[model samples]
Target: MVFAHAPVAIAPLALISLGGLFWLWQKAETPFQSMQIGLGFGLGYFGTGVSWLISSIYLYAEMNLVLSVLAVLCFILFLTLYFILAGWLVARLKTAQRQGFNWVVVMPAVWVFAEWVRATLFGGFPFLMTGNTHLMTWLDGYAPVFGVLGVSWAVAITAGILLWLVQSRAWVGASLVLAVLWLTGASLKNVEWVTPKEKPVEVALLQGNVPQDDKWLSKEFLPTLKRYVGLTKQNLDADIVVWPETAVPAYYDVVERGALRSFIRDAQLLNTDILLGVITRDDSHRDYYNAIVNAHNPEQQYQKKHLVPFSEFFPFSSVLQPLSELFNIPFSEFTPGADDQAPMTLGGHPVGLSVCYEMAFGEELIDSARQADFLITVSNDAWFAHTLEPAQQVQDVQMRALELGREIARSTNTGYTIIVGTNGQLKAEIPPYETGVLRGEVQPYEGETPFVQWRQWPILILLLGVMLLLVWLKLQARPSRKTTAED
Candidate 1:
């Protein structure tokens, strides 16, 4: 299953995805054929994209099976609208020759623009971003050099080459592009960007495997806490122990009974630091944050900057609150953290922390990695059980490590917990739906990556400028209307 471990190889699948739409558009023979093609592409892309929603709702949350399947289909169909627009744009821009000026440039631009649109529009579900799927393939070495945007660019270029081959039957050109990807991947396999200097730090990640339905119930609270604590106690020799998102269920202000603090103090007694996910509230009790708080130190707190749509907070809750809840939203009211939260420190090393869903945004995670020695994430995938979603999501996290040159320690409540190296290899991992802890040695590096220092914004601006400059030159080259008519 490409959807399982080898998710990074799915970029080529997009060719099948997009090409199928183009064929459909050819059959339609309509005025807005390009637009129709785009819609077709979107349908295929998102139809399969949101299939994980079935697992999330039915298997994980135990929702009614029929409604859960319907919900997943509806979500996928809804997300398909964006792909339609993407296809429309590409088709609409075709020159009189039935071919665009440069598909290489146009394809990447359109796809990147589409992905960006998908990430921001309608509260933005940026999951399964095409860029994330490139992790396992050596095509990802371009990540550290160009970020996910670069891999996205390469993917677009490959699409363009394929399109060109289709139009002109130029097999040589297509073969060359494929060869380049192969060679690049081969070269990257040998490249050692991060050297492990310090002795490996042993980490223990606790997966309580708490059922989503009972996780927040009063009766289940003690058992849930005990599950995590008991697991950590078993791994006391670990240098760092982590629990997945909201391992502590209630808001801290209400439940800060000092019980967790006492446990943290004991962990400190063991010379280990426990990084936990908990709900935190401000003095006014108005701002409740989805946060990662350290038990050993009161000073360190990592609040989640990116909150999930509908689940965290309805985009327009006042108007849609009733409708959102009617659909069984997980967390309908959560506060977002400030963008510039500092990386948390544990055992004297900077650990850049991001909550679940935050890892999907490559730029933000990479920027955070710039300052931190390693990357850490806490998640409760009790939302998406035994689906391609978690696998795809993990690949995204792995790419973040590769792009930013940081070690990743990801702990999930319902499994798929993994340890990834700077090169994006799964050095260690725990499977989905399993109750266990993953322990491994991680050597945090000190050197900075180009992506770590200079983020995606600079590269994007440069690309935009070049495209704009090209447009300006093309306008200048066009013959004057009067002269052309006289000729």
Candidate 2:
């Protein structure tokens, strides 16, 4: 299976998991064998997922290389615990007297519930969701409405149907389901929720290609500022221009000194609003924030609500502080911004802004999108370097755009600057590590989606209702079994 490269690593991982699930469905004949398959499957799924942790530790922490490897292993093992429990639950349900629930409901239930556990347990690592693999295909239409969780549901249901076909000769039913899904996808293909109004807003995204090593150093600050300003000057006619997070090393208050103020004044004079990420001091004496300052109105500012653990803000600092000091990365003490701040208006258009790490959290972006006309995410991906994470991250961003029916102007410090339309289409993008201004005209869109109206509460209630009905029916079928089990 490993030698067959056509299916890829994640496919192998899923296949291993499917093998374990099949063994569970067949009654395994022995508890040890059932648990053994579960363990192997859990390792396959998590071991591949945690490969990025090694890069994260090495890049973010100055830990010894060997220690970083060990950290990756430990993190993967820790994540596997959730999958292990999920495996055990599935096996238990199979062993129960309820034969009807064995494969039909139990498999899908455990799969969806296990994914929920994966998303929320241990501070949540919602990356690499199985639904993400279908992003390049017709299944992407389901993403805007259901988010990743919805995609996961479809995947699990398909898997269940496959199992049904194998056991009960339900090929016709499985084929019908597949046909309906494809037809629904086709119908959703051109169903746009919002129409663009007025002329497109021309914007420029400046990618400085700045190295993370020297981004914050005193000597590199002036050169970095000059590079961004030079790019901005070339595209000043654009309605709005943006720079990546911390594109300017100093805070807005600090940048007022010397020629910085004059440079900004020129930008404002050009009648274009320039939005750039800046570090700023809050009312509290020692508190700092990773924030975006609006040069258009001057008074309007939006700060990042969700801070990255360890990199932006440490959760358990008392314990992690010593380990952080070992890295020696500067200005890492970041404070979380208010969750209720209003979106900033640039060139008469409301722009919902998110700093680097905030993009990882879908909830915050969804909330901000509701109140704003457009979406803007500024990030510095120098930490991830040339890893597949950036590409994967943009895919998630596109999903958010489709979900919200809003245009996004995503600016990055190093590379992968992208603009996504409401349909999850890549409007414009710069090549990774390319140093240039990606100038494009993005039209503002308006309207609401099902996701925007009800959020996930409706889906949650529906799932709960199904579970309750299933349990009640099981109870009605076998009153004696329930009594004996309780006894």
Candidate 3:
């Protein structure tokens, strides 16, 4: 799992881990022991994979280093229960006793289903999902057809087959099967699912590089706002310009009458459109939203639908709000936007926008992307500076582009402001912790990949079928074992 994340993402290493899991399941003498082994593996895998969380807690939350570590441990332990459950199910199904069925069919089904549950339940922390490792691999072609979970299923099944070959000492057969899988994936890469719709439009993505400690400070507010304004002016020739989440560092009403108004006026003069992240308030309802708005036309806006847990909005706020205040966490509450909100029109094209962590929800993005010509995501990653969090985030954005078959413009505060092509390949990027502009032309796409249309339904149905079949096999085997016991 650690190898599946960024900086040193050798994605193929995931197969070795999956193979080891198969071996563990085969060797365990009891269901309880299998679950224990699963728990131990989950702890180690997630502990290292998401270790970056500790940096965010300690640096941004202002928690003590010791408390931060303990907090991360508690979170890892809670997530590990999912793995434990998968192990118990695999054991209960007695897949190990079913030759030619356990490793190939049952194990992969169990593993992928567990991952799906983890990504769906309890607000979901879908970080480091297995298929994300295949971003640069041939398996990435499968993303458009079945999404990340489908790719994960493919990897798990391949690993299970390799485990079977190792146990049976059939190295030649394993090599052939592996070659076929890789070759098929490579061939799929050349298939273009979505075609270009309009002429390419030049875009300027700004990386403000604001320090988290000074971002919200009253003394630094004016200077930060000026910096972004200056950057926009520098790239005014582009058809569209973008800023990171909370780039304005003030309420929409407050900024709209001040520098924001000037930005709108200047953009209109240049025949350019500007999209920026800001905190918006609805006075009548007294609700605050983390939203993106068009500086040239504030009426065109998209509020973030999916909010990050404990960061944008705390779960069980009535119980956790007091504890959050004690820890000095600011801006920890936000209301979600409507699920059916339309895409914003910009630069003669419809744009799908996601604010920071919302980019992780692929299904949520599909609705907006269905009518959008291009996709845009804005983020402030300073909370996780000096960690792999930003790199992993860039990868996730790349996957979204591939799944939707649209070019993506990603703007960020303090790192990885990148432009990705419709094929999920990086076109341009600004270095981390630097103030710079990523200038590129995004070729808007017109059509959808299979993933955009079907989403997770196909994969879920396939997994469900596999589970039911395994249950039937177990039931059929029960009577045979009883007869042998009677004899």
- Using lDDT as the measure, the top candidate is 3
Better of 1 and 2 by lDDT: 1
- The residue-by-residue lDDT of candidate 3 on 1-487, one tens digit each, is 6776686788768889988887888778899988998898899888887888877788777887787888889999989998999899888876555533577778888999999999899878778888888887888888888888888888988888888787776677667777887788787778989998868989999999999889888999899989999999888889899989988898888888885777676665667788888899897646789988888777888898888887778889998877676355556788999988888888899888888888887877888889999989999989889888899898888888888888889999998899998778899887899999999999988988989999989889988998999899888767687688998
Quality of model 2 by C-alpha lDDT: 0.70
Q: State the displacement of the C-alpha of residue 46, model 1, in Å, after optimal TM-score superposition.
A: 1.1
Clashes of each: 4, 0, 0
Quantify all predictions' global Cα lDDT against the true fold.
0.72, 0.70, 0.84
Q: How many backbone clashes does candidate 3 have?
A: 0
Ranking by lDDT: 3, 1, 2
lDDT of residue 215 for candidate 2: 82
Best by TM-score: 3
Q: What is the lDDT of residue 481 in candidate 1?
A: 100
TM-score of 1: 0.87
Ranking by TM-score: 3, 2, 1
Question: What 10-residue stretch in candidate 3 is worst by lDDT?
Answer: 94-103
TM-score winner, 2 or 3:
3
Q: Model 2, residue 321: what's the lDDT? A: 82
Model 2 lDDT tens row, 134-187:
554566676667666666566655555566566566577667886777567656
